[model samples]
Target chain A: MAKRTGQVRAITLKQVAEAAGVHASTVSRALNPATRSMVVPEVVDRVLAAANALGYRPNLLAAGLRTGRSHLIGALVPDIANTVFSPILSGASDRLASDGYSIVVADVGTNPARHLELANQLVARRIDGFILATVSRDDPVVDFCLDQHLPAVLVNRAEERRRISAVVSDDALGMQLAVDHLVELGHARIGHLAGPETISTGFLRRKGFYDALEVHGLPAGDYPCEAAAAYNREEGAKAARRLLDAAPGITAIVAANDLLALGAYDVAAERGLSVPGDLSIVGHNDMPLVDMVAPPLTTVRISHREIGRAAADLLLQQLTGGESSTRNVVLAPALIVRGSTAPPRAQSRLRNQQRGAG
Target chain B: MAKRTGQVRAITLKQVAEAAGVHASTVSRALNPATRSMVVPEVVDRVLAAANALGYRPNLLAAGLRTGRSHLIGALVPDIANTVFSPILSGASDRLASDGYSIVVADVGTNPARHLELANQLVARRIDGFILATVSRDDPVVDFCLDQHLPAVLVNRAEERRRISAVVSDDALGMQLAVDHLVELGHARIGHLAGPETISTGFLRRKGFYDALEVHGLPAGDYPCEAAAAYNREEGAKAARRLLDAAPGITAIVAANDLLALGAYDVAAERGLSVPGDLSIVGHNDMPLVDMVAPPLTTVRISHREIGRAAADLLLQQLTGGESSTRNVVLAPALIVRGSTAPPRAQSRLRNQQRGAG
Candidate 1:
């Protein structure tokens, strides 16, 4: 008679082995696909049939203990809801899935005080590796990962001098794309709405603005700049207003990101100034729905998906090789020209007047 | 010499007991904070000191095996990048965190063919409960959960007859709000852009629209309605164009979601029609940045965060009680009036003519 234990208690290997007329150790070897080849084909078939009849389930915890690897990865994002991080997360997740790894994501939210604590919790759960998207220039979590000899990769941002492995967009090139586009439109005076200086993207993009202006033979001092406290719409609006007030003569505004440029639009509306007619605006990170906004955003498009895939690949390489290598991958950024940017009004007027004079 | 072996091998309770001059069982009781009161103070101090010196870490897996619970919850989202899902996710995550439970989120993406496979994988990892944000009117996952007797709760959408517990917004009330606001503005001939009918939101909102029109003594057949295959900008634009072409007399359009309303804005621009002057538009789910878009979307605001919290709370209740209850919670929706909605041009014309005649 078949013992009907139901599913209250999971069917154990002993039960399956007994039903198969084999030892428990033999059943274990037969159940494992890697070791099944060593077992007789007839014995393996008997073990599988008995296991299926008994509804035997292998415990992942026991497998993990034997292998010393959980095949699980953790991804820590500052805000999971933030539109910028989701694409990167999906890209990384898909890449990791292809390598037979599952990800557990932790949303750190706005307060990063719990970053190290959360990482430690995942470590305690025996997560094999981590992909950190919530990195500052100097982060305690990065130090912890290094000290613990854990496989980790930084995505979207890197520490100072590329001290760790990271996959990030070329922020300087992104800024240059915005600057050169505005410069080509014949704008002599352009204002920069910089992002928070504590992060890599903010710092590099701000520096790139100056370098791009210098490359075009324009005086950096003529371009007014204001640093936003965060990469948000509210912060962008405040920084944009400050820049607008500081340099009223500036014909075009180059924002550090699309949200900041959207803030520039609000300031433009408040001052009763028309876009391209009185001022032109340029943004970075051509995120979703940017094209649908009022005048549509003209910005630098960063391939965040590619960055995510590269970050995952780097982490997997470190995990498989059993050595941490510091390799920084920089992705290219392209300018997506849209309705938000046009030739400066003063330049257009000067050209029209010159035509009249001619 | 003190054994300086690092985190490679986890220190067991037997070692701690040997160092503390106590039995392994005594060390176990002393280590557990809940049972520490039963142990003598001196023995507890010795066990703690020995544990600290040996760098002992509790094995959650072993503890879970003994307790028959894993304290881990799985959250399955349709598209993690979808803005609508983020707030709900954060809400559920935060609520779960309060109960000392951690979540592993899986982004199933658009193709839900692998939903059951992912759930089964999580089951193998011993996830205690699930908060499903992806549920159709007749879902196979819900049936599986019932058959397996797993603790599960649905969020954002529900199945027919409320057979399973769910936390959802009042779709009918949301539609009523959009319909009433437009009717109050004297829009006699309104158009509807419906969402895909497979989901509950799409079906319920469409039904609500007709019911609200009937309540307002308006003819449902008089209002032209077009269904969008998906709630996206491109689909919204197509549906809006179809409605516009089908019923040129329709003075206003009410979209099922904010993204769809954004598409309406595009179609309006394409036709060289000015918003609020030529036509009024209303949307649902006042999502992030809807206020900043062009003429600002006037829509129904559903508290997705509250729904997420409620779903988590319900799942936690079931987990702690070890029984599933069929309790469906429907949150209320409110109307947010913005720049997008106004009196119909025909109504404005009639008023102006009346004033001129008077």
Candidate 2:
């Protein structure tokens, strides 16, 4: 292969050193923020001025080799195109930027093997740490990080074992809030459109749904739950079909994700059941554009951006403090009431009948 | 400062060479796909087997230093949360991944200075090339790339000078389609919600709207156009309000972006005017969830993923072919007709009157 070279040569430290009338070693020390204190104030200012005048850009790759710190964080997400992950990435990136740490985002997709392969690639590229938003309930990538003793922080999702710091929403509280709203609206036969059980969010949210049902004095067996293979609209539609077919007379559904809930909306439309009129549905995440969907979405809103920021903070803490203790930061979720949910049609009809009798 | 280190020792090439009973240089040559041809097939097979057995991960950074190729591409986007850019990133990433290139995505936001700073940082990190989706009509970043002799490809937006390769949707054709659809529906008094003219998309789409109006035999002077300061929903809302207020008889609007069109939707809601009943709105980009929005958006569908893939291809061509010729790949856009547009109320009334007389 031919040697790859830029047409215009980059201004180097030697050039800055010569211009500043200082040794190359002194120039390097003065330029680095961490080592600037070792140099005299006047010399540092002179070096800075010379570097600025020359338009000298430091090669961070060489600096990384010398210091053994890349200042690059690798963020692995399941799907970059998903609306739910976007705000999280944005939030994490903003917080990391303030700390002078650049994030390298990798969309690992849904393949478990690909996740490990990408993570290894990032490690090979010398990323200082990882912010993983793609962890499963029992992920191999989590074990790989642990075995490698790499600094990693989980975002949006967590491993079953708290081996590393994680920032996520209170999944159970979100489910409770969804169930409480449905129960108050007199929806007894509420089904669940569950996500894939392999993932942490799906597993915990499904568990939370059952737990919420018990709290509401509703029988778990009475309300059937179907788990989607993935957290996409297509999988959600298939799962919703099975759930509806198995459990007739279902008045409402609580989906583990917004995409799945949208899938349920598709199923409802296909069955000629108007949302809130025939089959009221509630979704989680309250992802972008859910509020604008037909009949809008009554969903549990997780602070995804906050989760991202918190994840970055936790990773930074690990990098700076070198503390080994694992901490789980769980943010609270709120229910966003919209046009997708209302009192069940049966209950509304009963109220009208009672009013007529009175 | 303390040296950062992973607890587990990585498998070294020396160990792999020892296991394969070959010299370290031979092992290295056998390992690199580009240099494997230098070694005999048997020796290469032995080295590969030993490396695989030892679970040895190659340090790409070290290899990059020697080869002057990181196989890493930096993609700078204006906003990570924008749904339009997500698919573009994903498509570019997927295509690049097949060629052993990993993309480092930096969300530079809307700040022009930040774009340059991030580009400089990526250059400092020795990225092989850049895929910039943040270029304005006369972007300094474009000039910076030219001055630095960096291989860069523009996506979604382009510079007027055409110094680098770009993959963009035919912005004028998109506007013509939107306007033609509305004109076919008997919309004569059409207004425009223009994006910031500083950006190429905003400028081209706005100019296209007026050009389309002229082609449809409507006077451009009669159509009031308000340009937003940004592509965001808030800016779009402000521009839409001014456009509606300035042009009282406008029955239809062509917005520069989906967010702008949604902003028009907000203004219509505030005025208690039903969509397609009191006002018709058309959006550009046909962004994610626009199809699900209440009175689903009628808009132009730019193949963003295709544009992204094409951008990656152009950048790769620059890298592998070492070509200097600038190319602009303009993909065609289709109009997505939905519930957000219809005939003017006055035109519908006239049709009713004619039917009654008949």
lDDT of each: 0.81, 0.86
Question: What's the lDDT for residue A338 in model 2?
Answer: 97
Compared with the true structure, what per-residue lDDT tens digits does model 1 show for residues B54-151? 87766656666567676778888887777788778878877887776777777776666778877766666677888888845666778777767677
Q: Which residue ranges in model 2 land beyond 4 Å of their true spot?
A: A1-7, A347-358, B1-5, B347-358
Write one digit per residue (lDDT tens) for candidate 2, span A34-116: 99999999999999999999999987777776676778899898877778787888889889988878888788987888988
| Per-candidate iRMSD | 3.4, 1.9
The digit string of per-residue lDDT tens for model 1 on A23-47 reads 9999999998878988999999999
* Least accurate 10 contiguous residues by lDDT in model 2 chain B: B347-356
Output the number of the DockQ-best candidate.
Answer: 2
- Encode model 2's per-residue lDDT on B118-201: one tens digit a residue: 888888878899998884777778888887889999998766777778899998999999989999998889999998988888
